[model samples]
Target: MATQEEHPLIAEYRRFSPGSETLAERSTAVFPGGDTRSSAHYGPYPLVMDHGSGCHITDVDGHELLDFMNNFTSLIHGHAHPAVVAAVKEQASKGSAYAATSLNQIELAELIVERVPSIEQLRFTSSGTEGTLMAIRCARAATGRQKIMKMEGGYHGSYELAEVSLVPDPNERGSLDAPVSLPIDKSFPESVLRDTVICPYNEPERAEALIDTHAQDVAAVIVEPVLGSMGMLPASHEFLAALRRATERHGIVLIFDEVITLRLGDGGAQSVYGVIPDLTCMGKIIGGGLPVGGVGGKRELMQLFSPSQENPVMHASTFSGNALTMAAGKAAMEAYTGDEVKRINALGERLREGCNHAFQQAGIKGQALGMGSLTNLHIASNGVLHDARDSIAGMIAAGHIPRLLHLCMLRRGVASASRLMFCVSTAMGESEIEQAITALHESLAELGPYVASERPLLVA
Candidate 1:
């Protein structure tokens, strides 16, 4: 167990991040929990970042760390890439937002449509949240169905509809074959819960069965190719194929929420998997580290939004395709070619291998699981996890090990999500990968005795 001196997690957090402590305390007066994003918070506080350049972030305390967070995987090229900076600066001088369309927006859309084969046409929104919402609404409008089928523990966004059945309690999650649709919060209306059908992840037979059962009422089945918020769990090819077959057979729209997974490859996870959806929701890196979202698919489906006459689904955002974001996005996308994608993915593989080797060498039972350029560390003796329930159980059994390990990595000049998922960027090289591996070695050493004592199950 952690010694009495280290029992107070908050104290250790403050000792490592004193500046963040002060900043968090001050910010709490305005923002809830001293932070705006719920996913970014830590035990005591988060590092108050001043600025970032390339793959490094300098915090207010003058600590420079390799930025694996990458603004939640949005900055594929990392911070302040010269091309993106030039584009943003140039666009800023011209104008920021205008209700009218601009050439920059058209150019950006053209690039996206050209790269992603599924996207014959596209429309932009202000966020991934809005992108998923718009896709769901479009599906509903086209099919005239009400209910939506989402994977159990799949997170689309913050909205009530997208968040249905996100964090099911262990006891109430129901059988693996027949998952229950549980509300994420009380704010979700009973009708919303009723309108959602939860399917177990990576379970092809169960997914097909559930889709078949709910086919009459379900307008769409939305899923992340790689479950982002739930420990970077990648869906099996069989499961995704099953969804495609079932959705097609049932006349339901299949929507792949590639908001995070878009960074995986040239055509996104859909391209990698060779299974295209009826509608694709995208965000994150596509905007060049700015706020942007898009839904694209076959022209027949996407044309539902045609403003030529009465658009079926009403969609408009004041900043949907603002000039600045378009400029930056175009620059960023231009820089990211097939070669760049392969390089970053190779880096991610190296990171995973190094972390896994470290765990094995330390006689700790854990696994680094993910795909392409993203990876997540889960402390479990059960090997790689297939779904969110497995991830949640691993986290609960590991106690505070992952959290402490995260803090330990930060102190060692490495930064990742609090959950320990690290993403590789174009800015990172062999040196960054080695540094991350060394940090993992050091962090596991620091927490070794505690896991051996209190969490023997993790090391068993």
Candidate 2:
């Protein structure tokens, strides 16, 4: 099955994406990394977009790819859903922004409150980064505690502390009980590291003990039910429940950063796990495809942001409740009913199963692990995976295969996050899911020789 010994892996990528390379060269003179967004950047370059509709996106090179990436899973209905497009267009025609409250904002908030069990009152933000940031600050203000406990490898946003200890280096990740807060980049301040208490993910007893140990100063325990950036590993029920129990007992706020996992169910992952959080941070589908985010919870915690309060948290964003985003969110939520959510979740399950089968057939050590609508492809030694260490090990073993696999899928008219995370959109069904699976099977086959020649440990 060895194709060509002379051709290198990255050369294959360059061959397939000449347009992206051209665009990257053109972009480098302006943007620092030849791209404005660091998350979207990969080894060679990224596909430049032309337009998208439904689940398909046409690139600048005229390739129509099935968009599994879906703008990092924010496009719940996939690009330009009729209802969302209509709502946004109508709102835009009327007015885009007003530094005051609007009916659309209220309607969108009502829709979110109605579905999410824990969110009684909510505050909108321009981005998920702000949502999580505000949630943490609110927790601190409410509890009067300065420190926050976050799971290792859990990425809440782009901010410093949110990403502290996010990439646990073997050289610096201290111990399992007390993880050293490793900065993702040089910009992270010492103060940000000091305020953070790192907790090992999925280690119930250790995590609970750590949370309890720092209970006095720990303002909040923030976690993602589905670990989005760390290879899409879902937190075990016991771990999340432990955090809830520990935080409750110690007067520490428990926040579910559902920015990604809210799509798991009608009421979010908290509903799925049967554990409630004191505060929930939401993004993605809530805004349809528009840029929006929000933080919400019981009135007690949420009310801290209310103007009626004497000393309210200073949470402000100019476009927080912009008319266009609100209208888009309302329309998106209105069309995304309980039944529709379940349908997409079922489709997600189908996609996962198909991808797993593809890995088996291709003789690769990998698995698709996630819950509900979100899934991530991990090149693991086993079919099962649990924690951050496992995810890191798998990535190390796979080496260039993940990037190569992503490129291979792209060439075959499929699109996924550079990290290989996928979310099912309402625009997708079994056929689209099957196309992705077929693409994966073929991509893995095409990659087999490279895997054997380069990283043979990846073979099952």
Candidate 3:
């Protein structure tokens, strides 16, 4: 199916997913650049997925791949899990949504509150963006402050400020103590830069200084327990502790954007670190593969959103607590017990070891970094990355190898985030983990000669 007219690698890729190219050609007319989602977009064209079951997905080109992307870590139970499908089917038969509230919404909320200690009371939203937005509004309503202090590489949502300095250029980003709020895209307004006070990640002292400096005007300090967009970097316990202490001292609300990290445990990443945030934003895994998001926290703070209040924050969405999403979420969360969390985390540890082994065996400068079931591959000699700046160093060391590696893996029947994010699902067992490990070794082998010929520094 590959056309001989293209580059050998592109031709081989086309051969593997030829139908994808044909579909992509047609898609460009409908969707910009043949893709609606930017994260999933890559060179040539992404494989057009036809269907999925458990931990595997089949493309239109007839290539079956072990799906590690899991719809950007949303499918904790993987595609078409029996429980989720049954829930969706039953809810669909009745009705997808209604003007009135449903019992399913309460059930899902109760489930989340039971697991996460910080979330004494909660509210649902249609997406994580709304969840973070409402959390900030609640903070402002409570403290009567406007500005927010966020970590240098933290990504809370799709908005301009939420992604401020998501990929901070070292040249533009100032000192760690007073990091300049740099916009990732041109869509950002100057107001976003003025309102957001950027703090260096994993630097407790710098974070403390920033919070103290902006304490008077800072309403909330938001951060991700594990920086998802910046290479799965885990925030240090000391750093989080600093934020907690500073926020408490300054009456500034602390928000933990646990959207991607809710999968870390039944209690989420905050439980793992033993440091709780005043507010927690959640999504992905909780939605049961349907679009969903939530913000939950202490009773006093949550009271700001209560309708009983005279001038409460007006938070409304047609699909905020929709029945279908709640039913599916309840099913997924109920099945994803504490024991299952431990099991998947154990499997993640195995996968990490396997990847480290693969890099060593292949004599390549690559390492796997993450917490629990979440993982990201970094091409670097450095063993661990603590912040975006550290990740930039790794990015430079690897050059364009990571993208080539992703394409190579896709051809070898494996799929992950273009940024190389890999997560474990309840649908995957030791066998699937092993298969992925083998894929890593084979992928590196296929890439080794090219790296040796092209970039010698990548060789160990």
Off by over 4 Å in 1: 1-10
Over 4 Å off in model 3, which ranges?
A: 1-7
Q: Residue by residue across 325-376, what tens digits does model 1's lDDT show? A: 8888889988999999999999999998999999988878887999989998
Residue 388 of model 2 has an lDDT of: 78
**Of models 2 and 3, which has the larger lDDT?**
3
What is the per-residue lDDT of model 2 for residues 1-460, given as tens digits with 9 covering 90 to 100?
1136434656776676677778878898799978899998886678888899999999887889999999998988999999999999999999999998899899889988998999999999999999999999999999999999998889999899899978788778888878888898899899999999999889999988997788899999999998888877888989888988899999999999999988888999999999999999998889888889999999999999998999999997888988989999999989888888899999989998999899999988888988888999988566567777778778877887888889888999999998999999999988999999999999999999888888888888
Which of 1 and 3 is ahead in TM-score?
3
Once model 1 is optimally superposed onto the true structure by TM-score, how far is the C-alpha of residue 315 displaced, in angstroms? 0.5
Give each model a TM-score. Answer: 0.97, 0.97, 0.98
lDDT of each: 0.88, 0.89, 0.91
Stretches of candidate 2 off by over 4 Å are: 1-9
TM-score of 3: 0.98
Give the Cα error of residue 254 in candidate 1, in Å: 0.4
Candidate 1 lDDT score at position 269: 91
TM-score of 2: 0.97
lDDT of 3 by residue, 1-460 (tens): 3555654566677777778888899989899988998888987788999999999999997788999999999999999999899999999999999968799998899889999989999999999999999999999999999998888889998898799998898898987767889999889999999999998899998888888888999999999999999888889999999999999999999999999999998899999999999999999998999999999999999999999999999998989988999999999999999999999999989998999999999999988999899999988664667898889878877887898889889998899998899999999999999999999999899889878877799898
